[model samples]
Target: MTKSLQKSQSSPSLHPTRRFYWDTESLGVVGLFTALSKVVSLMVALLGGGMNPFTLFLKNGIATALLVVLVARVRKFGTLALYVLVGQIVSFLIAGGGMSMLLPSFLVAALASDALIAACGGYRRIGAVLAGVALYDLLGRAISLGYSFLHARENMAMVMVAGVFIVLGYLGCLVIGLPCGAKFVKELRHAGIIREV
Candidate 1:
């Protein structure tokens, strides 16, 4: 190759470390599931008359977890975890929270879930995803408890409710998230983001 061409080619298009962050292949599937989760959640919320946005929370959490799982299928869980964190923050703004004191507690939950799943080894089929959902609940409740203790906005009962909601959301996730994770991995493999085992 000509020296000019070689130089142009040699200049990296991205930081070598960052290539995994933008997994376009997985993003496609994540996009699809996001829409589905949102639609289903909205309908459920409108119909169930549940309190404290139970359906909406599950929908958003499951979507977030699925997106992150898709990322983890092809990239490091830590990198994907950051995406999850940023996504929650962005979703908060989009949902009308629009910035305020204290970053969303969901950010903390996402990191915790990602760490647990990473510890289990990135996307080992379905077991790893269950670990992720369970961790999401565990960490989310932890945050609610901390808030209850520090801010006194809620008492033990309220904190316990938060845990209950997390559990409820996770159960919903299990119904959807596990299959989605497997489908996400399958898509990434088909799209060549991850190699088939």
Candidate 2:
């Protein structure tokens, strides 16, 4: 009798049309991070560093950290990367910056950040991811500076200014992102939601 009962319980039916709130929570987190990244990016753009000393350091750093959060909190890195890239392409087109200046710079930042984050082990431990992200921003900005020096303007001062801004960008990431990422990871782990994704 005990064996039969155990068999029955083990074979209990699962609901065919059931739903859960897990995805809802995941998407909410994803949206929050993505929105924050966009706002930070807008601020960076307003600073107008693409052609000057800014070199979009803040923009890339924030964006990288945000993307890391999204990957850790919600979707896979590839999924969020594609979405970010699509959004960037559309936004750039609408803004109508000169393709010669915008296309390579945008591609460099997007691809580098994505690749770096992908290199980070696993989906959690956002600090490693953030470091990768910071590196991406730094590398892309360096590449852009090189491009400008070689083809666009050729000024040593411009390179120095861009370098400084890139450093500031990394510092900004360290300030605004490190705490939030650690907090989220803890929460997710406590909730047993880390394995859900």
Model 2, span 1-197: residue lDDT tens = 99987776666374444565445666566556656766677777877745343435446545765665566666454444444555556556655544335455656665666666667664455655666555555665566556556653657787676557666766555665455556666786688866653
Candidate 1, residues 1-197: lDDT per residue as tens digits? 69977787667783355465557665655555445545566666767665455564557456645554554554446543555545455556656553323355666677777777777776654566567766765565566456545654457777667656656665655566556666766676679766655
**Which residue pairs in model 2 clash with each other?**
49-55
- The per-residue C-alpha lDDT of model 2 at residue 111 equals 63
C-alpha positional error of residue 181 in candidate 1 after TM-score superposition, expressed in Å: 6.6
* CA lDDT of every candidate: 0.59, 0.59
TM-score of each: 0.56, 0.54
TM-score of 1: 0.56
